[model samples]
Target: MGEKDKAYVEIYDTTLRDGTQAEDVNLSVEDKIQVALKLDELGIDYIEGGWPGSNPKDVQFFREIRNYHLGWAKIAAFGSTHMAKYRAEEDPNLRALIEAQTPVITIFGKTWDVHVRDALRITLERNLELIRDSLAYLRPHAERLFYDAEHFFDGFKANSDYALATLKKAIEGGADCLVLCDTNGGTLPQEIAEIIKEVRSRLGKDISLGIHAHNDSDTAVANSLMAVSVGARHVQGTINGFGERCGNANLCSIIPGLVLKMGFKCKAGEPERLRRLTEVSRFVFEIANLPHNKYLPYVGRSAFAHKGGVHVSAVSRNPETYEHIRPELVGNSQRILISDLAGKSNVLYKARQFGISLSAEDPVVKEIVVRLKERENEGYQYEAAEASFELLMRRIVEGRKETFGFFDLISFRVLDVKRLEDERSLVEATVRLKVRGEEEHTAAVGNGPVNALDNAVRKALLAFYPELADMELEDYKVRVLAGEPGTAAKVRVLIQSKDGEDRWGTVGVSHDIIEASWQALVDAIIYKLLKSRRKRLEAA
Candidate 1:
């Protein structure tokens, strides 16, 4: 068998299509094409573009990016079987698939009995006919056509005979490849392996088999690997596991697992760019305007982080004791967090990470670390405020004072109004604040109450801290802490602020968005203050 056929299976990235379908993850056509080109550069085998005829944006994407060349990935256009009882050649949707002018096309068909009768409102025979017609029509018009057996595993469980019959339809219909999709996202790893084994045996190695799993049960990664172990050659997922509901399987985990653990090769003579895995993962999240998952496998911020004394010691002695693979292999790094559970080594490592070298005999640094942990137990999170902790350590250990503190907002209020002159009403804010124990009251107009409050509060502070003049609010997110309605919801606000080269995160929880925004705003200013202090120290 050729290397692509034997050593490791191919990776098909569907992050563009299925991942963008997730709630609140709408990327423009420019974003889609840019990300797709990057994936091709990364040597991904296939990149599934969106359904062309479904929406105007998708249609625009197909039109705008039709001529761009994808060197590595075979761009696959996604759609469903033309409506039931309709001939594929006559269906407008299938025709749109051809009009897109992509080399590959993928269409899903009902494999589960429930979808056959309930979702499609069609007979089993007609459902089979739909799968057959869709694949056959695209087969002649397109170079490659893949048939997705939606909910195939579950459908097989509900009615194994019927599911097998559907697979036969795709086979007879000239599908270049068949993917078993866990569309409902409920199948387990063992089940995936068992059923894939059965399918491969029944299909008799006549065609390529694929696995497309969703992470409803958090087992999507495991199930994908299990399927690969059984015989599936192609694996489908959204990058960073972005998808509807739970999510599709995370390609971040799958790619490294295949290359490093399962010994799959991307291509011979190509430098192993698998090390760029984490970088690409973060880039995709940035393009999608989503926060990177700090706990995600391989690429997450805490992927190889260790804090326990014994574990850190063991890892420092030999990384293999704690890390499954060296973090550098995936473009990640080793992190040591400082907490109450930390030992002497943890403090030393953390200090060094901040460019401070200390010996074990530095009793003052040790005492300061313990005191900081004590305050952390009281709800002061220094992890997001490393620069703050460093300054505090310097003040305690080195007695370096002569510093500056920014203004504090004492209280603020947001009032809503509806003026007859404007259809889009605005919110007004009032604030009474203090700077270094001096009093100042300010009011500002803004699009919303929270915006008005933020402007007012910052206006009060920008005087003392001129850097605040240069800062911009990158992102603001609100989360409800309790399941309640009508002025009862406790809310949390997370704010990201960027000033020149420095970006900081601050979080606040309160019963009011204004109050929460105030806390977050204050934290942001303080983070900037500490950051400025650290820079001064480094320069000195």
Candidate 2:
């Protein structure tokens, strides 16, 4: 059969079960449904919703999703094998799987003597019995049965005979699919390839195979690909590399490579599912309240971005000279970073990218670039805060100087309380400022303490530049200091604002999240108003 007609590869996502094991990740049923719908729309074959017996929330999640049409993907309920000595029919864990009402069920079986003898407190033969009985018991009830040989990689290396024996038992027990797990996340890619080759060579005719690798050694991606090359047809992972220890193999990198490069039919039938890769990669991080990845392959902020004089010059001539693929092919955009490593070509190219005109021979480009490096060396990363960088560009390259840019807020404070009516919470804030003409005092209230503080600062600056009303906070971020919980609080805030096509960021540091938010908010407003006047002057 041709590649397209070959037995189709299945994409099994464990974002709910495996992904939640990532540090500080918790998703409500609604969040799970939103992500599942996105995954289903992307055409994944299966979604391992969660281990239902582990929590009530997951049980409810299956109930909630069951009411909706699953489209191409079947929501699989995940659980472990029946308890060490209990019959599969009487085990509550097995019953929980039945109650989930999913068409598919995945149960993990112990593959390592270490886990069997110590963790499960069962004999090797008895452990294999659990694997056999669990699959046989559930196979009759479900449309599909998958057995995850948890820690199979390590189990194989530690005791090759037992590991292969476990796979044999599960296959004989009527598992529709058999999965080899790198559960401890300590297997090397070459080891994964060698063992997978052995498994493929010996059991090639007996069972269909899949892989579940982890990233503890940072080789999960490589190991996963190695398994695929060695005849594994199913790839099990989470979107955006979520899981325990380091993380699972990054399905973000795997699925695209499989479908687009290896010609595998992993996305059901819709090949266009490739385009949603970057967006869903970002969407998952957002729902989990995590920061965006800057260098994630095929989709990070810097994947296509170029810096350095030589690099930017060559990129301007032909993007393919530097870029592996057109960034749009993967839903990412190219950027030019301004840094101390940047050369004249880099400066000019970045200036042009922002619609600001500057020449290599122009003294202003060189002057501003040097001063910019100096500012960054002192703790201003305009890269992460492009809004701040644009304001600087408008001031110099475009000859847009501001006469009233001296509005400086010396301090600000915010206070809020929910102890109120069903109405919105009360927010109060005050600011002390020094304007070019004279110092000013202003106060304002908003729906929250951060918004109130932002209002107070912006209201104070509006006295000097009324255009501040046109500028607004587009985004805000607060990061607490490492190793310090709350005692001596330290916060960092990044604010993004836009006027027309120009956006800039300003950052602030304080002991209070509210104070830091106001500082960055004020910087963003000032930066936006300044850039607008600069662009007007450039046009003039």
Candidate with the greatest lDDT versus the true structure: 2
Candidate 1, after superposition: displacement of residue 335 in Å?
A: 1.6
Query: Relative to the true structure, how large is the alpha-carbon lDDT of every model?
Result: 0.76, 0.77
lDDT for 379 in candidate 1 is 35
Clashes of each: 0, 3
Please give the distance, in angstroms, between residue 106's alpha carbon in candidate 1 and its true position after superposition.
Answer: 0.3
- Cα TM-score of candidate 2: 0.66
- Which is the leading candidate under TM-score? 2
**What RMSD does each model have against the real structure?**
8.3, 9.4
Off-target runs (Cα >4 Å) in candidate 1 are 1-5, 267-271, 338-540
| lDDT for each residue of candidate 1 in 258-326, tens digit (9 for 90 to 100) | 767776665311344665576678767655656567898998878988989998889878989999998
Question: How does candidate 2 score on lDDT?
Answer: 0.77
